[model samples]
Target: MDTSPKIVASVVYGCCPTGEPTVPVHLPGRHGGPNRGELQTVNTYPAVPATAGFFTIPAHADYRASAATVAHTRSLSFLKPLMGGPCFDLEAIWDEHTRYEFADRSVEETMATMVDEPYVNHVPTLTGGIGRAKLTSFCRDHFIFSNPDDTALELVSRTVGIDRVVDWLYDHARQTK
Candidate 1:
């Protein structure tokens, strides 16, 4: 199965004759990714309150990461000198890292997404650590393994800046023990 990431960039028109842009609500794909070039007709979303206009749907389907994002990353791997600094999709990188850490629950895989010397600081608990070895230890013994089996995060909002992507999430978990 293809688990790469897909890009959704299609806009649908609605009943608004005044041409005011309708609110866009992303519809989840059935096969883990939205089908490419397929038009999704949604009168009302399952739980979300649908606005009076059409709902925007995903344009591409079933992707862990888009091919364009992958190619951009690969091309940048060779242009570090010319660019002077890394130039890649921050959102894609963040998504990949989180997927490895939370969903896959692989400390090694999570560490592979970070740098040689990285640091993690949990502001609420004032936990986490610095350096690769310390961070890896934290992930193995404290962070990832400590989560409950039913843990999930609902992203409320995300701000992607040039150098950073800040995500506001709501943690939904029921402690099993």
Candidate 2:
């Protein structure tokens, strides 16, 4: 039951029937091909019995396979969709959050968009709150209500992923005395 990663000395490339490598993977710090220039095909190899019309080319025993290569092979195109990434539109949900925070400036609306018992932590100023009650208080006191007269945000870039959306923005605010 040891789930920790162990060092691998070689990799095996599974090839399709067309002689094309189904997984054209190269493990870093490990060179391609076997230890000997004489490559072993399924017909010539005996250590591993051929199965399901697939064949493999074993790498050199002295070379070590990188951890990234192992992860890459497991997450290949054929398996990624089956792994169950998010199905909803994360960008639109995030846009609604921002709209509630800035445009509407309604603490109730902002909190409505979040899950129950959600938390926020402003890293720079270290000034957000945890839990439903505390976050609502923080939003009303220090965030939504404390904005300057002309405060606005201009998004520079946005990257949406399966679970989250990251946005780079320009905040335009004018101080008022």
Candidate 3:
């Protein structure tokens, strides 16, 4: 199978059953949503089978059913942790083909130095609900090298509260060996 990021996915944070988005207090160190709000323009909309809950802008809205979200999950409340590191900078992996890092160098400097996608800023422009830091960490820890596309699925899980499903998939992947 081919492992490539054919899509772009965003995971939103701070929402409840009815979809009330709040800013996370001292949100984790990662970069997405409000933490870097000044650098982005988010576009949002929702269409539901009621069960598919709600979904937001995805990384690769370029794909079919890419906006698809699992039913009955949709809760931004799950991401109450990770106001720290690791998962915070995970979005940086989105541009697998590019070379950028949040090291001692400024993100602006990195974005400006991008020799690949001249359109790419070291800072990614994202759209979606807020994302959970723990979930964000989990995705980076596991899929960083495999199918970063899994991050897309993870984002879907975060939007709704289907993290258990994500956990199951990861666990099953381990046990199958």
Candidate 4:
């Protein structure tokens, strides 16, 4: 029942449920508002994918105006002020995003371990030339493992039986600290 995030941060391109909020249609011609005397038009999202939960972390400002860019760019344009706070579609997510956040900590921890290994070392420098498989692996591992808070990560790890992930990150970070 508790669907809170395992970690929290100013993420970029967050899900936008407001694009289709169920509001009382009491404004103008649709429900007899000031514009009742004139013609009115309503707006809605077009080209919805199979799922809405899917989205990508766009890295550039120009991409905000176009989804095709995200499809071909194959790069992460971090909205530093927002941190990927907009939502596109499932296909867009599949196209642009390499990493995603789940509600489980163990999943994130496991992902981190996988990403931190030699096979995934080229992720830190966010270049766009990497293959989709490699890029996605980085995304999943980077955010899931590289959280800034220890307490929160621990809480998530314990909740999801990631004792190993917790121990690994803790020990790993401690040695560096």
lDDT value, residue 51 of candidate 3: 29
TM-score, model 1 to reference: 0.50
Determine which window of 10 residues in candidate 1 has minimal summed lDDT.
16-25
Models ranked on lDDT: 1, 2, 4, 3
Tens-digit per-residue lDDT, 20-139, candidate 3: 223322122222323345322232223322222223334433222433343112322223242221122223433321222212223444334333333311124332122344333333
TM-score of each: 0.50, 0.52, 0.17, 0.19
What would the TM-score be for candidate 4 when compared with the true structure? 0.19
Q: What is the lDDT of residue 130 in candidate 1?
A: 99
Least lDDT summed over 10 consecutive residues: which range in candidate 4? 159-168
In angstroms, give how far residue 68 of model 4 lies from its true place. Answer: 15
lDDT for residue 123 in candidate 3, whole number 0-100? 28
Error of 1 at 117 (Å): 0.8
Candidate 2 lDDT over residue span 1-177, tens digit each: 124233211233443223333332222212232432222222123232333112222353422234323334433432335445435676888899998898889999999988888999888899999999999999999999898757888999998755567799899974559
lDDT of each: 0.58, 0.58, 0.29, 0.31
Model 2, residue 142: what's the lDDT? 92
Number of clashing pairs, model 2? 0
Clash numbers, per candidate: 9, 0, 18, 16
- Supply the TM-score for candidate 3: 0.17
Best TM-score among the predictions, by candidate number: 2
